[model samples]
Target: GAGAETALLLGLPIATLALIVKNIYNGMFIPLLCHKADAYAEVGDTRGIERMHLISGIGLSLTLGIIVTVSYLAGVNMVKGFLDAIPEFIKHGLSVATGIIPALGFAMLARLLINKKVAPYFFLGFVLMAYLKIPVTGIAILGAIVAVVMVNMPKFAASQPAPAQGASHDDEDDF
Candidate 1:
């Protein structure tokens, strides 16, 4: 999923190579080798587990070597042609989905975190970015500063004790 999304954003031969590597390692090898290893572990077959591990390492090494060799031999034009064969609409859709996914993640996080007390700061950040046109990095720094100050304010306030109850003004002033 990530490789495919990044392939659209990058449109580089490396991205295609990454997609192929991920498909092989994650899609094929993980299910094929790792699941069998899990079965071996469950059965208390130490020899079987060891064999699986050795096979997994060798298989992964061979896969990587073969993929790198093929990709190098195939050259950029082949990768580019492969990329070009993908429909424009699909490319646009993936781009749009890529942009929206993070926003949805943020919204989900905000739903859990935001409350009456925190809402003001949330709006403040939104206003800073929307109205003031401050960049996100600037807003993040400002937010950090505000957080530090807010956290320390009570400590600073508590550091100085209030004058003793019913103390004379002159007695307090004498200190």
Candidate 2:
């Protein structure tokens, strides 16, 4: 019971740290790289897109490698003082961080998600989870199905030729 309580208490801060790491990397850092790729597209430099992809791949691999190495070190107590220092101050440090991390996470998300185009989708997913009780796996599969359908849907309206100057001013006048 004590161990379970301790585990539950510790989980919040660890999960908060994980969320911060995931959001910063995915929402902020990755987009910066994607923006760089878009800059290349601006100049018609297709190679820059490929280069960004390569850089991102390398970066992701390096990050994972470092994480694995550090985790292994921590697990076996090979990191010595660093390993010992964590719990020495976890109550002081992580308790504060537990509150701060979500604030920071929401700040980051406000920038990323509170936009006109994206907010609706965000609320839709939130509703699906909060009210409808759709599982995340089901939502993801449903999203993918919708995405596939949307992508493959015809663009006849966009592809259609504009009416000749004399053909019809009727539709334009209504607008």
Candidate 3:
């Protein structure tokens, strides 16, 4: 009863706040932060951009809503069946872990998106850790280390000088 009452009281306000934040971020922050040429060229004007953002936001919410609803129902059924079949100790372990996996997934996605350097190797390392049966704590440490190392790798090639126009080189002659 408390949970239901709380959800009833807070849900609408929370949803409203989320929509406001989404609109502000999409309309103002993203445009300012993204490449000016790309944003303006694609959207044409503020009104057009706003419309695009609104449509996209609605579509994304609709899609995610359907997916999450289905997943939650399926998970509930599967978890119920599992609890019935499994030993008490294993059921308890799984019950505890069910609360953790979503948070872990969110953290992983945030890390990958915010730190582009780690994005490439993060999934690969995750697969390797899972397949190799590495302990969860070990996987977390290794993931962090790999992400840091990848993020800090030098951009030496980007800083290299370009050849001058009309400059002749032996490599070019050979080609």
Residue pairs clashing in model 1 are: none
TM-scores, in order shown?
A: 0.55, 0.39, 0.26
Task: Give the whole-model CA lDDT for all candidates, comma-separated.
Answer: 0.78, 0.68, 0.60
Clashes of each: 0, 0, 0
Model 2 per-residue lDDT tens digits across residues 50-152: 9998888787667656655554445423433333455657546656876797999988988876988757767887899899999998888877887677766
Candidate 2: misplaced stretches above 4 Å? 1-91, 151-156, 159-175
**For model 1, how does the per-residue alpha-carbon lDDT over 42-135 read when each residue is reduced to its tens digit?**
9899998899889877877787677657755677677677767878896776668668979999999999999999999999999999999999
On TM-score, the leading prediction is: 1
Candidate 3 per-residue C-alpha lDDT over 105-170 given as tens digits, one digit per residue, 9 for 90 to 100: 988878667567656656766776779877878877887886676666656545677767886767
Highest lDDT: give the candidate number: 1
For candidate 2, report its TM-score.
Answer: 0.39
lDDT at 16 for candidate 3? Answer: 34
Candidate 2 colliding pairs: none
* Comparing 1 and 3 on TM-score, the stronger one: 1
Error of 2 at 163 (Å): 12
